[model samples]
Target: MDNLLSSYSPDFPVASDGTQTFDRDALQERIARVRTALTTRRNPHGAVAILADNSPDWLAVDLATAQLGLTLVPLPLFFTPAQWVHVLAQSGATALFCAQPQQGAALGFSAMTDYGGGLLLCEAPARGGPLPLPGARKITFTSGTTSVPKGVCLTSEQQWEVAHALHRGVSGLGIKRHLCLLPFAVLLENIAGAYTALLSGATMICPPLAETGLQGASGFDPQVCLAAIERYQAQSIILLPQMLQALVAATKPGDARLACLRFVAVGGARTPPRLIELARMHGLPVFEGYGLSECSSVVALNLPGAERIGSVGRVLPHRSVRIAGDGEIEVRGNLGHYLGEAPAPDAWLATGDLGHIDADGFLYIEGRKKDILITGFGRNVSPEWPETALLGTGAVAQAVVVGDGMPFLSALIVPATAAIDAAQIAAAVGLANRDLPDYAQIRRWILVAPFTPANGHATANGRPRRQLIQQHYAQQIASLYDTTEHIA
Candidate 1:
């Protein structure tokens, strides 16, 4: 904490929520109060979990826990109730800080005291034993496509190094104000977005998700988000690819309302090259990057002057990227350990992604190595590549491509709205197929319901669970190969 605090000036603003701004001194006071409360209020061994919206107080709790060398777990509001129960029980969290005291109590936490910024500090029943996380300062759970989310254990140094590398990468851009678009529970936004902003001496503007037009897991309104960007004069922001697509459609050519934006980082999913081009055409500077929770946060990012359109940009100085014999993208770096597990035996972490590096050192991601589909004709296909095209049409809301060990590819598509008919979906698929290869094109498809986390068809971040979806719709998928009721 001392080393981290020295990086920030004493009087400069570091955090704000549109109503209050906290300078270094004010922020330090909050951290001290939290530290004092924790030391005097709870057991010394168990972990503490925070369940609240994005606010300055949440940042304070994170800093305080880091200073005390205590384990802190951040819970995502987008998770379902059952997920919350699972995390609390599995992590054995003895304390919680949340906006709603009643909700915390219902989850087996009793109200102890009221922390500032409308957060209630509560305590839970004692666990049977110590937490499984060793030498871990923070435990961030991944919103996996499966039913259960896994916790990634990270030390303070690992997270700080990633933030410092990110600060060094874009220090010349002079991004003074960064708006928090994604939830801070997301490791990408927490480490790369907020931590990097603090290291670079940039003020982080944090607003509630509702205020920024984000609700639940997958709800986003680009118009409301654009209003926040303009209202706060945000010079830099991070977004998911789907959010970027919506912003591109909302902004007109040479839109002056978004003139304040200088750097927009898009990641958390594969971004189509056309979306990046479209965003630039609308006067928004969108840079694509890539990373996962296991590598801390950001591994590579496209800078202002240095960028490759289809690539995720060059690897950062802190990490090294190499391709395996099977063409899997493996990263050699100081990675964190998985919760309740031992350290990795190997030096390089196999990132389950298939990609290659260019001569100039830019990294391009093809798709998930496990999600790749092999056809009967022995042609390898990445569903994400074609799914990106299908989503680009703006008429298809959700799509899952499945054709492993089959003659041709097939898709289960959900239209943007109920007003869209079979003819509209066929036209959209045709438009998407025009750019794809002959073997990769969707020869047959069926209109289906939306895929969501609540339905076990997708992750909290909205990435489809291919295997589970395939198992659930095995009969439907089999019928697609048959000659009956073909829509496309």
Candidate 2:
């Protein structure tokens, strides 16, 4: 508690909506009330599922769960009814707290009473018993790229460690306002954005993602997002790679809407170096970084005055990193808890990612080891490298690079706008291809409709589900060799 609360006073703003603002004093009091309510109304150690949006009420529940030392399960709004059932059952969550009672009804939940601030506490029959996590205070579900999402158990102690480290990591940057772009359920924003803002004495803006031009998991209006930043005068924000690209495209030369931004941290995917450079050219203050759920949230970051163009910056001082002989990044210290059953506690976790640390200690990620594509020529290519390059062109909104058993590479692209012509896309792909080697270049290409989470083509956090991508475009991928390019 001290690590997160020590920097703020009674009156400092903690979180806000368009109509209301909650300060530190209000947060503390509300946390206490919720803690008392939970203790009086629910089982001591049983888990509670939070099915809500970004609002002051959600933070109160989050802090209350930590304070009461109870288990919390955050259910993503983007998840389907069946996925929600699985998460709630896996976590043994009997209490469902949500902003809209209708949402609960859609998931077979009936209202018990209002939990206050437009939240309802409903009861559900448990499917599985309480999980056997001894010290776990929260269970965050993975993005479930190709399958059902798994739970990741975590202790408040581990979460605070990351938050405190992040506060210190970006020290002296004068970051006073932080706008939460991703859903609060996403661990990246949960731990790094909200928690670190409190620890750093910064105000947090938790407006509904829709208000900022985010529609579900697929639609984004970058102009609306920029307006929110301007309206709030936000100093810093957390962004995914795709979001950064759109924001960069939305900004014009000498655009005053971005003048108040002091920092923009991009992650949640491998960022192309060209995108970072483009952002700088357009005067958007963006930096790239990396992390996974297992390592809490943020393990490495690129901050102002200490940034590398293609690196995820230095490993955070709180954790240590060493590259494996096979080129995987190995992490040591406080990797946090796991779900279902955790792997045996060990000194280091091999991150399934393949990367190397530079002489300057900056970590440069190539791609996921499991997702590497093997061409017919026996050349190994990580799709992210080329996919990132394609996205950086500013002509395409989405790209999926795959050529797994083929002689050469092929890509499925979604134009950023309807105004973008085939010639522009062709030119963009040609430009992006210049940075790649022969075997990894797109030999045949197809342009398809946008891939989005709602369409099962992307995960909740904006990552492409490769199998799903391949399945949806199976005919196009198959015809690429024969027809060249159709509506593809």
Best by TM-score: 2
Per-candidate alpha-carbon RMSD to the true structure: 2.0, 2.0
Error of 2 at 145 (Å): 1.6
**Best candidate per lDDT, number?**
1
Point out where model 1 deviates above 4 Å: 3-11, 416-424, 484-486
Q: lDDT scores for all predictions?
A: 0.85, 0.82
Q: Per-residue CA lDDT of candidate 1, range 236-327, in tens? A: 99988778877886789888868999889999888888778988889789999999788898889898788999899999898989999988
> How good is model 1 by TM-score?
0.94
Clashes of 1: 0
Model 2, range 1-488, lDDT digits (tens) per residue?
A: 62455567777787887678878777777777677667766455678889988887888889888877888899988887788888887888867789777877776667466645547777664445657487888888875686587888888877888888888877688788898888889999998899888877888888988987788766888999989989999888888888888888888667888888888888888888888898877767888888878777888998777789999998888789999887888887677756767644446988889999988899999888888999998999999888888887889888999889888888999887899988898888898989999988877687787777788888766788889889878987888865645432
TM-score of each: 0.94, 0.95
Steric clash pairs (candidate 2): 447-488
Candidate 2 residues lying further than 4 Å off, grouped into runs, are 2-6, 125-128, 343-345, 483-488
